[model samples]
Target: METITKIVTRFGGVSLLPVAVALLAFVLIGAPSSWVTLTIAGLAMGMMIFLMASGLSLVFGLMDVMNFGHSAFISFGAFIAASVLAGLSGWLGSDLIILNIAALFLAFAAAILFGMAAGWFFEAVIIKPVYKDHLRQILITMGALIVAEQMILALWGGAPMTVHRPQFLEGSFLIGDITIEVYRAFAFMLGLAVYVALYLTLNRTRIGLLIRAGVENREMVEALGFRIDRLFVGVFMLGSALAAMGGAIWAGYETLITPALGGEMMIVVFIVVIIGGLGSIEGTLLGAIMVGLMANYVGYLAPKLALTSNMILMMVILLWRPNGLKPAVK
Candidate 1:
């Protein structure tokens, strides 16, 4: 095993795990029909995980801050989405089916605004105070998470809030013999659009380029007369907005909103981010894709041990590369 580890490490630990995943997938997909179904499911899951981790990557990259409360923002977005949809349904005098369009639009807006609110608060009070102190940010955000949780409980009660699929989005879309949920299809498209737009912004736009450069050397960028403080605001806001969008989509998928949703999702997000790298956007996307597929397949193989797959991957990656699969060195 040690010799095997040394051989794999020589080529980069990142390649080793993914290579393992590929072989496992190849084995599982020996049958054509089952393989196609699994592939579609994996693709759909990968899209959402990518978006979720993208936000986390951006924030961590520029700010050198670990937003432990990001999961709370996700919960905030989900509940806000549910509340908006419910309100829209009431206004239309129709069921969930009748109001999906307007409901989704409003939910998107609500999630963005709520996410911005979380970012602003975090940046001003908690995050700002802990400049180079990751421990402080973690502690403070954990406290904020508790308060946020309690407040949610007070406002919405402890019962789970279920959202019914809009009439148009209720049924599954059958492509041949495989049935795919209409909403998952919608989420996948949205996720792709978001990823493309974000990727372009990071790679093409001037602001995006500056952010990338800054992530490489914050002090250098600052010394070069770039307006880093303003850029930080933009980065934080953008990350938060992405987080909210992901939350709204997630709410649509599950059709239920709970205060604990963020906490539960947080574990996965953390695993994805850590496995991918601390400050690498591309790493986030790749890690998300692997985790998403691993999760679904793990559940199929061992329902009780599903969550362990993600954490186990993260542990293996950390042992091999302490900085992660992709660290923002360039």
Candidate 2:
């Protein structure tokens, strides 16, 4: 085990896992253009998953809250963003880029705002009573998720909603034989920007310091007069907002969404969190990227195995490193 750890560390650790997977895929694919296209698609998909899962990771890792209802935010965010874009169809179809940008911004803003508010309420009302009790947390959160899905059904009906994209994000870019969707590129950039902001905030700021300290020793921090409960609520809210933003972007990616979107994505989000080491943001990103790449590559290579690829990956990873690739220091 020590020898394997040393080898991985020598080779730049698990961050290179994606690169290694990409290289293997390139060799198997044997076509430069196809490989490039697949790689980019995988990266973009990974970023979207990261956005959705990062919040769940933090909530569970730091707050010790098993929020099975997290995916409810994803569903709500997608629907809210889609509704906003639908209402602003004129702006989306306008020739003016400014209107297009405004419409897009409003849709995302609404989703984020709704997510934050909902998260705060959930934390305060549903979660507070279940603290430190894993079984109750799971049961209540799952019930909350079911209720959320029913709410979506009531609001949007049973039809699969079509999500319209702004003019700016409606096309694809071609480079030689490699083609990249503009929306995918936008998603990747947005996810990366969020990651940078999160990394800096968690590792470099005073609030981050307090959060980390609270995570390590909540009683000590509370004794030091730093309102840990309030900080936890903020963390929950941030996580929920991120999930909503991710859903909004994913809605555009899928172009069609249903009430089941959250349920479908919940499994993938949890897989990423568990295999990525619970509360570690970096680990979540790594797990998400690897899942993305593996899914795409497997779908192309062996369609029958694609559905189970992530589960297989998780099993193998656990067998190799049970603690996950980059677990946060407790």
Candidate 3:
């Protein structure tokens, strides 16, 4: 085990996991074009999931909060973005690209803003009292989730709402034997961009330094006149906003959403968090990408095992490294 860890570390550690998985899949599939298509789709799926899971990773990993209601932000974001796009159908279908872009921006912005506000409220009202109590945190968050679902049903109703794509985002880019959807490409780029931004913010910025410090020694940071509580609130809000953005993107990817979207996604989101390890952005990204690639490859090669592939992957990874591929240092 020690020798294998050293070998993996020498070869860029777990960052090479996605590439390794791809290589193995390529050999098994034996078709370059199909392989390429599936690979792109998998990456896109992974990115979207990363967006949803990243925040929860921080909330659970760093803040030590078990927020089962985190999915509420996802559900609200999807519904809100869908509603905005629905209201801006004319702009979405317009011949003008600027209008389409504006509409798209507005939809995502609304989702993010709502997520931030709702997160603040949730943290202040429900989560604040439950700190350091995992059992109550779970019970309260679950209750909050139930209420959120009810609220969503009351507002969006029981119908499945169709999400609209912008004019510029519609269609596919054909390259010889392979056809790649423009939306998928956009999603990949957006997710990659978000990951880079988050990496820089958490690893490079002053605010990130404080957050990490607080996690390590809250008493010292507090004694230094830093408001640890406010910092945590900000962290919670940021996490919620990220989830909302992810949900908004996912809504476009699915093109149709129902009130039960959050409930359905909760399991997958939790899986990604657990797979990535707590409090590590890099780990979360790695875990999400692995799940994405595994799901797509398995679905294509063995349809019957598609649903269980992630669970299997999680088990294997845990058995190999119980703390996950790259857990953040405490």
Candidate 4:
């Protein structure tokens, strides 16, 4: 047990597993251009997943809340953002880059605001009552999810809605023999920016210190004159906002929106959270990238196994590191 603990500890110090996997895949594929394309696509997908999963990870890790209905926020965000974008179609279609950016920004902002409001209600009404009760949390959150989906159906109808990207974000640029979509590049950059901002906020700020301290020992933090509950509430709202932002971005990525969007994405989000280790942002990012790469690579190499690739990856990783690549609590 001591030896095993030491090994896990050693591995936890550095995040090299994902890099090793990428290198192995590159060698196995034996096609530089194809590998490069897959890698870029994988990275973009990973970033989107990271945006969605990061919030859940933080909430679960810090607040110990099992929010099964997180996808509801994602769906809501998508719909809200889509609506905003649709209303601003003129700006989005304009030839000016500034107008295009403004339209996209407005859509994202609306989605985030709505998500924050919904999160507040969710925490206040549904989640707060079931604190520390995993079974109840699951049941209640799942029930909320079903209701949320029904609400979406009523609002947006059962049909999938098409999402249109701004003119500037529509096409792809080629690098040698490789084609990279503009939106995907934008998504990757946006995700990276968010990750960097979050890392800084959590590691280099006082609020972050309080959040971590509160998570480790709420009583101690409370005694220090901070309102731990309020802090947690803020965290929940932030998580929901992030999920909504992800949903909006993903809606544009898919160029279609559906009520089932959130539910469909929940699987990937949970996989990322679990594999990355609950509450560990760095772990989540790495896990998301690995999953993204595996999906793209496997889809191209063996289409039949694409759906199960993430599962297989999860199983293998769990077998290797039961607590995940990096467990915040541990």
lDDT of every model, 2 decimals: 0.77, 0.94, 0.92, 0.90
| TM-score of model 3 vs. true structure | 0.97
How close to the true structure is residue 263 of candidate 4, measured as C-alpha lDDT?
Answer: 99
Please state every model's RMSD to the true fold in angstroms: 3.2, 1.1, 1.2, 2.1
Report the Cα lDDT for residue 189, model 2.
94
> What are the per-residue Cα lDDT tens digits for candidate 4 across 133-226?
9999999999999999999999989999988789999999999998899999999999999999999988999998887676567788889999
Model 4 lDDT-worst window of ten: 5-14
TM-scores for candidates 1 onward, in order? 0.89, 0.98, 0.97, 0.95
lDDT tens digits, residue span 101-153, model 1: 67667778988988887787777877778878988888988988888888889
Task: Indicate which candidate wins on TM-score.
Answer: 2
Candidate 3 overall lDDT versus native: 0.92
Model 4's alpha-carbon lDDT is 0.90
Query: Candidate 2: TM-score?
Result: 0.98
lDDT (Cα, tens digit) per residue for candidate 2, span 1-330: 778779878999988999999999999999999899889889999999999999999888778999999999999999999999999999999999999999999999999999999999999999999999999999999999999999999999989999999999988999998899999899999999999999999999999888777666778988998888899999999999999999999999999999999999999999999889978889999999999889999999889999999999999888888978888853
Clashes of 1: 2
> Which stretches of candidate 1 lie above 4 Å from their native place?
1-23, 90-99
By lDDT, who's the top model here? Answer: 2
Query: In model 1, how large is the Cα lDDT of residue 27?
Result: 84
lDDT tens string, model 3, 3-90? 7788878988888989989999999999999999999999999999999999998888667899999999999999999999999999
